[model samples]
Target chain A: MTSPRRVTPEPFVWLMFSAGGVVAALILPVLLVLFGVAIPLGWVEAPDHAHLLAVLRHPLTRLALFGVCALALVHAAHRLRFTVEHTFRLGRYDPAIATVTYGAAAAGAAAAAYLLLTAFG
Target chain B: MISPLEARYYRRRMPLLWWAHRRSYAIFVLRELSSAFVALFIVELLLLVRATARGPAAYESFLDTMAHPAMIVLNLIALAFVLLHAITFANLTPRAMIVRLRGRRVPSRVVLAGVYAGWLLVTAFLAWLLVAA
Candidate 1:
């Protein structure tokens, strides 16, 4: 009888990386323009406190926000992992580097979830 | 400790600044660096959410902080990096994905055009939702 093949987590990580990259590429530019530039600089009408709060309180908004934050961080982590490894010649410490990068991303995602789910409401 | 057989081949170590030596290499490095800015933007967003949750006063303060000259400059830099990330990712999507239609391979330019169309539609929808609505 053939033994069952063992699966690695690499594919799952790459899946998150791709999803995160696509989402960030598509959605983040407009958000950055609105929040960072237009609204802050008074180039566009800013959402009032109550209006903004109401939007954040919506379930769909919270979910979308959480997703964007979590996935973007994962995408960043994956890219930074290889970039740092190759640029700095840290191949010997690959395991440690991977842990630190992915760990930070996971922590950031958890923080996002907490803020979105509890703090916002 | 080098063995006789291994010593026959010359191994040249890559310079740490090799990316700086070529324009394409430099752009590649910059593209990689964009990920750091992406993370920074997410952190800022999380802070924004946290401030809003704290109350109206805190949210006002957050906006005040964002409006500061230094913060504006930093965000502008971030906006540049984000654009780089977005554009490069969009351009590369056609190469990375293989879309099939009716058992025939889809041309790359068609796929790229579709991606750009989707991006435009998404941006337009978001603009309407955030600004008009």
Candidate 2:
């Protein structure tokens, strides 16, 4: 008998795409209505916060953007270091994995700041 | 099984196999990693924008929140982190997109040009919004 197929180990980067997907999905319809209807008809300002409200009010929208941002940050941090290590062969040159690890953490923190501080403010 | 020269040759040859087999994994890692910085920078700017546009009380609220020492530290760290992320991403983009011209590897200068151009376009657009508003 054939052995059962093994699943690929987790791929985390897709989580960022997923988060981006949710934001786009929730925001897109409001954007379409604004551009397709309200803007042309002189109803919505580009700076209007109505759509922001639509997003904030929806539990699903809030969860996706915030949750995705957090998960994606960690995923991106891990992936970025991995890529840098291989691309530059920094392992051979830099001889310090801490630089890569700390750098990834820093990048991920920046992203988290953007979402939390700015989006919420 | 034996010669020092043969081992040397194999070691040099290994990078090709490593790159070919692991290229996607590498790319994914780079893209995701850059996203972290972009995400934070985006959120911070958005917050400041919303607060400023809302008027004095809101702006005061922003100051109120920023009064927290923790936030100041976070922002400083984010700024440094974003700088690192942006520099790395711009250098990596040509390969990330697999951009090539006429089957020759495009020069790094050309990729850098595209990155700067993109930065200018974004800055100009945001400037226009500020001026118009």
The numbered model that scores best in lDDT is: 1
Q: What overall lDDT, based on C-alpha atoms, would model 2 receive against the true structure?
A: 0.49
Native interface contact recovery, all models: 0.70, 0.08
lDDT per residue for candidate 1 within B82-103, as digits (tens), equals 9999999999998999999999
Residues A1-121, candidate 1: write the lDDT tens digits: 9999889899999999999999999998998898888888999986777777887889998999899999999999999999998888778888999999999999999988888878854
**CAPRI verdict (incorrect, acceptable, medium, high) for model 1:** medium
Local accuracy of candidate 2 as per-residue lDDT tens digits, B72-102: 5655555444444445555656666556789
Tell me the tens digit of each residue's lDDT in model 2 across A1-121: 9999877423444554344433322232232233223333444443434343444435564454455444444444445555666655665643365456546555655554454444545
TM score of chain A per candidate:
0.91, 0.42
- State every prediction's TM-score relative to the real structure: 0.93, 0.39
Worst 10 residues of 2 chain A by lDDT: A23-32
In candidate 1, position A43 carries an lDDT of: 94
Note the Cα lDDT for every prediction shown: 0.90, 0.49
